[model samples]
Target: MPAFTIVTTSATQDSDAAEVNTLTDDFGSETEALGYSRRMADEMLGLAAQLSLDFDYSNVALYDGDLLEEDLDPDHPALIGVWVLDEEGCSYVPAAEFRESLAEPEA
Candidate 1:
C-alpha cells in the first residue's frame, strides 16, 4: 500500500546559535498527511505568537505519497506540497506552485 511522509522543519534561536530539526512521519493517505502537517505547523507558530517570542520559521512538506518507505527526501521530486508559516498565518503551497514562487523576488 502507498503512504505519505510528512517532513517538518523547525528553526530555533538561542544566545549561542540557531538550531534546526527535521522530523518525519508516515500517513495512510495524502489527505490525512496534509491535514496533520498543517495542524502541526499551525500549533508551533501559534504558540510562538501567543508567547510573543521570536518566530523564525516552521514548515511541513508532503513527500513520497506513492511509496511505503519512511526515508523520503524533502527536496525530492516526489514532494507533493508544503505548508509554511507565512506572514498572514500558516499557508499551504502546492509543490508545483511553490517552485514558481521560489523563483520570484520578494516585494
Candidate 2:
C-alpha cells in the first residue's frame, strides 16, 4: 500500500475545493485521474449552486498516511482522502462550531 497526497487547486479564489471522493480504477493513468477529478469537482460546484451556497477553492490539501511506492493498483489503493467544502465568509468557524451550526436550522 502507498500513500499519495491529493491537493485540489483553483485558478481563482472563487473556485470550490472538493476532496476527491471516489477515484476509479482507471486513475492509474495520469490523464484519466485528472479528468476524473475535474469532473467530480464540477459536479460538486453544480450541487453548491443548487443549494445557493458559495464555494471557494483558495487552497485544499490532504496528507495521506505514510506510504511510499507511487504506482499501485488504483482499485485497491490507500486512502482516497476526504473533501471539506470551504465556503467564503465562513472560514472563521471551526469544525466543532460548524457541527453546532448544523444542529440548528437556518431561519
Candidate 3:
C-alpha cells in the first residue's frame, strides 16, 4: 500500500493554522489521488454553494511518503508525493491536486 500525508489549514480566531496528517490506509498511485481530489472538490463546492461560503481548493493537500519526512519544509512550493492503490474490495480517491489548484481569479 502507498502512504500519503494530508495537509490541512484552518482559519483561527487570530490567524491560520496548518497541520499535516499521515495515512497508510489505502491509496497507491497519483492517478488515485487525482480522481479522489476531483470528487472531493466537487462535494466541497456543493457544500459551499449551499452554505454561501467561499469554498476553494486550498483547503486540502496530499503528500507522498517520500516527501513526508520528519523535517518537511512548510514553505515548499512543490507537491509531496502520494501513492495510489487498487484493491478488490475497496475504493478511494486522493485529493491533493484539488487543493493546489484552488486559486482566486486575478482582479
Candidate 4:
C-alpha cells in the first residue's frame, strides 16, 4: 500500500495554502486516495476553481507525500508525479515538470 497525502488548504489563502498543505491522514495507496478524494471531488473542485491552483490537474490530489519528501530538492530528476488542475479538468504532472513550472515566470 502506497502512502498518500492530501493537500488541504483553501485556495484563497495562498501563503497558508503553500505551507504544510498535506493532511494528517496517511492513505495506503493511490487507489485508496482516489476513492476517498472522489467522495470530496465537488469540494475540491470548488477550491481549485476559486484559487486557480495548478497543484492537481484535479481539485483533490493524492500527493505521494513520501515520494515528495524523498525528492525535496526541485533539481532532482527522480521525483515522482502528482495530480494538477488544468482546463482539461484533471491530469498528472511529473514532479520535475511541476517544479520547473513553479520556478518559471508567469506571463
Best by lDDT: 1
Q: Which stretches of candidate 2 lie over 4 Å from their true place?
A: 1-28, 58-107
Q: Which ten residues in a row have the lowest lDDT in candidate 3?
A: 82-91
**Compared with the true structure, what per-residue lDDT tens digits does model 1 show for residues 1-107?**
45666666656444344344444555766787778888988887887778765545557777765443445544568898888774467888898887777778989
Ranking by TM-score: 1, 3, 4, 2
In each prediction, how many residue pairs overlap at the backbone (N, C-alpha, C within less than 3 A)? 0, 1, 11, 6
Tens-place lDDT digits, model 4, residues 2-103: 666555333333243443354535676667776665555556666667876544223344455555444243354433554554454545566677787879
Model 2, C-alpha of 30: deviation from truth (Å):
0.4
Residue 74: error of model 2 in Å? 21
Q: TM-scores across all candidates?
A: 0.69, 0.35, 0.46, 0.45
lDDT score for residue 22 of model 2: 21
Better candidate number, 2 or 4, judged by lDDT: 4
Q: Which residue segments of model 4 deviate by more than 4 Å?
A: 13-21, 26-28, 34-41, 46-61, 65-82, 86-88
lDDT (Cα, 0-100) at 1 in candidate 4: 57
Badly placed stretches (over 4 Å) of model 3 are: 10-24, 66-78, 81-107
Q: lDDT tens string, model 2, 32-95? A: 4444444555555566667776655422223233333343222223434323345522122333
What is the alpha-carbon lDDT of model 4 when measured against the actual structure? Answer: 0.53
lDDT of 2 at 76: 29
Give each model's whole-structure lDDT: 0.68, 0.40, 0.42, 0.53
Q: Per-residue alpha-carbon lDDT of model 3 for 10-86, expressed as tens digits? A: 22233354333433334767567555644554554455457655422223445555455545433344445322211
